[model samples]
Target: MCFLAESKINRIVFLSTVTDSFPKRHKGPSLTSPQRPTMRLASGHVAVQLHGEELTKIQKDFKGFGKGLVRLTPGGWLLPAPYTKFADKIYNTEFRASDVVIMTYPKCGTTWTQEVVWTMRNNPNFNHPKAGIPVKARSPFVDSDMLAHLGKDVLNSELLELVKDIVPHPDPDEGLALQLTANIPDPRTIKTHLPFSLMTPNLLDTAKVIYVARNPKDVVLSFHHHSRLMKSMSYVGSLDQYVDYFINDQLIYGPYWEHLREAWPRRDHPNMHFVFYEDMKADPMAELRKLNQFLGTDLTEEQLEKIAHYTSFEEMKRRDDFYREKEMQRLDQEVSKKDGGFFRKGEAGSWKGHLTDTQEAKINAWTKDNSQKLGITFRYSL
Candidate 1:
């Protein structure tokens, strides 16, 4: 295992301990009620304090995610870093005539959106039996080794391949490293955390996008916890400290407001629509119907019922393989505090259970300002 600095260990341990505190007794609407428009992310409810290196780590990680591929872009706009060597594979892959893009900041609703879209396009009656095929096999990561030979293309050694045997891929083609982006970024439904500036011009020119939004409080709660599980990010500090980085535009593609703004301008172009996870949870059936119409498909009543039945929190937990890779089979041992995998508790309004009121409001304020600056006027109740 790669060893982190001793100080880093202390930082992680401290934050973990704090976030693990007992949950406040829910008083009805606190976790579920809508926050008033005047109530902001920084509403004196949540307070975060972080110092030194832990703060620096987040700044660095964000910079890296932003610059992944943008050094080659003209103005440094959409700099989402793909695996350098495999960048071409993602840009040049064969795309279907009818593919739709699902874009979001990580941990927003990427997977759920995938499920929603898959149901909409392939089986409108998401509740029906056998509504769609296995996901990973069909939804490949454009720049990862599942499709491209990375190092040979960009001159870096292979990374993250240990998980390769666990994740499935759609095409059995030679994982070719060619860049087909001369025409446009390939595949019908590519995933990205890229800002608007760095993305190749062709990506926006030809594709329709479905962008997902989540409360910044929740995003930080989920994302900071996620870093703990991702080996590359094990060194970062607590959610509180991470919030500082987030506010400063120092988290991956963050300044959640800025990264989000990159898409908002295009949200109403007849090819883009923004969906909030909160809204999805509050009215899933309605959202599913809206999604169905957007995808240009219709679902039978039976299929719709089946989808609603299966994608529930209770149902997803019952399944052994919702968002898990086979490698997680080893993680099946007693759950560590880190939770061992990406899917964690996919519940909404989970922020109150962890973040102090001060910190929650602070993040919310940052969220509100950025939301306005960037033109995203969505609600983030919870």
Candidate 2:
């Protein structure tokens, strides 16, 4: 099913299948309100006016459903239970030849990498002193249900205006990624947390994918804090309980081992590149150089240094309001009601402070087992 929205001369299209299942109710805007603009597509899918600030409360309510509300699809992958219907549409989405996909397991420096890549792609000469746009808007999340739910006309009108000169492709109703790709010009930046198994069949052949991996221990700690912060999926359990879920591969987009293993073998593929979060954190400049080389951007030493300066953890945090104001607003509201922001202590080995000796041992053993089993090695401490 597809949703068509009129915004100026551009037509925003959202494609999603109809499903009887809906997320559990919470204290937020009603999806069935008659006053809001609504459309029923030929595929029996219904689109509603659930974009912009209106979704903030609904997102919080959805997060309250907790980790137990995951959806295990027939494709043998897990997704946020509430977003399964959206994921269903993304799973079948198409790919474009000029796409640059940012692939990662959740909380594995997805945002940081995105900033670096987008800057490199659009501002190679460093002529643009400021980003002048949010990172999320610049590189839209391909599998984002928010984008799918809100439609391009609403969520990306600002972004579309920013790059309209560069993106002249025709529109299609395939999915968010395709829609964005069609509008954006060549070498479009796209992000996703989908495991390789669930990705488009021709993605490796058609697009350049930067896959980032991090130590599961750190990923767990960051993810725990992130989960708690995002009201839609906050966890009320102890760190021990959360680690149990991590060790057992029950977290969203987990089986970390399986996800990593599936993609590890494809690392040598010409169009694919694998990066370790630790390496990027350890020497961001070196990683940036590597990225510039891989992405075929002719950035000079000065340009590279400038990119590093702007995208550093401190700078990104300082400029969060500029790059991620909407997300920050949601998280800030969450913090007021709860307590956490998307950009928590961006450090490696942060897990050491939170994990007990026994818990550390458990994570270590699990990591060792999985690393050996998958024929991959990870630097647990930086």
The per-residue C-alpha lDDT of model 1 at residue 85 equals 29
- On residues 1-382, what C-alpha lDDT tens digit does candidate 2 reach at each position? 3223322212223434323333331222234433443333222324443444534432443345422233222222344433433443454556676678999999999999998998898877657543566676568677764333332233333444554454465233333444554455455788888877666667889889999999888999998877676544545667787887677655657667777876899999989989999999899999998988888888899999988998888888777745455444234365434544677778888877688999899988877876887888777677
Error of 1 at 203 (Å): 3.2
List the candidate 2 regions with Cα displacement exceeding 4 Å: 1-63, 66-76, 128-130, 146-182, 322-329, 332-340
The digit string of per-residue lDDT tens for model 1 on 1-382 reads 1111122232222111122111231111121212211110111111122224533454455322212221121111222233332333344444454667677876887777766676556545345343333443334334333222211232212222322333243222333212211122223355555454434445555566788988777788788766555433342456677766566554544445655756777777776778888888787778877876776667766666667777765565555354344444223233334364566777667777788877878877766666675665555563
Predictions in order: lDDT: 0.49, 0.65
TM-score of 2: 0.73
| TM-scores, one per candidate | 0.64, 0.73
Count: clashes, candidate 2: 4
